[model samples]
Target: MAGVPEGPEAEMLAPNLAYQEGFGRVFLVCAAGRTGERMRDAPRERLGDTPEQERGIVRDEPGETNRIRPARLAAVEED
Candidate 1:
């Protein structure tokens, strides 16, 4: 849901577009209880991350995602 501003929604997505350009990919994070400012600043904070540091971040995200997926699938299946 984040990337370069394009299509008819470019104006609305300007911030995310900037984020994508700053980072190698879209800014992905949990926003459940976060403010807009926090979300906007999170990726920027990591702008100076080294390749190894970013690799560590990248490696962790998928594990977190994988951990969530099955539980979510079970919850939906129960419903």
Candidate 2:
């Protein structure tokens, strides 16, 4: 193809679509929707994690609160 990036076609996802890429393949992921925040963080009116054991970093916290769960890093197939 002309002027297209010379590599595998990288997929651009729609909003709220869960996915991860490793090596050359991408996998779609969905949370169990359990007793905690979303894969990223709580609602703006988030749950007071101080009131519970947090699954990962709370972005609302003071630091790199980019919390990631097992589903966020599952089955990391290396190149």
Candidate 3:
């Protein structure tokens, strides 16, 4: 039910299969290299910030520690 995929193709496919098979929520955490870069660049809505605004904020952050702080604390923090 829970394991790492054998490769990229498997990683992409597994979440869909898990969702189709009735998993309430399927999360594919690809946090390395190109995958991580793509995800970070991808637009997402948060705290009423538009995609453009979010992108700008990302660009303005000075370092990785600042960049990742919001994401790492998001689930636990109310705001």
Each model's lDDT comes to: 0.67, 0.31, 0.46
Per-residue lDDT of 48 in model 3: 48
Q: For candidate 2, list the clashing residue pairs, or say none.
A: none
lDDT per residue as tens, model 1, 1-79: 6765565355436655665786667756655457767766666666677767867886786777778789889999999
Q: What does the lDDT read for residue 45 in candidate 2?
A: 22
- Backbone clashes, each candidate: 0, 0, 0
What order do candidates take by TM-score, descending? 1, 3, 2
Estimate the overall C-alpha local distance difference test score of candidate 1. Answer: 0.67
Tens digits of per-residue lDDT, candidate 2, 1-79, equal 6754432221223111222221112322233443333433323222333323333333234232234444345645431
Error of 3 at 44 (Å): 9.1
Kindly provide the TM-score of model 1 when superposed on the true structure, using C-alpha atoms: 0.54
Which residue runs does candidate 1 get wrong by more than 4 Å? 1-38
RMSD to true structure for each model, in Å: 5.6, 13.8, 13.8
- Superposed model 2: Cα runs more than 4 Å off: 1-21, 34-38, 41-79
Which lDDT tens digits does candidate 3 get at residues 1-79?
Answer: 4665666546555445543344233323334344643543322212245447545555554465556767868956865
Question: Highest lDDT among the candidates is held by which one?
Answer: 1
For this target, which candidate reaches the highest TM-score against the unseen true structure?
1
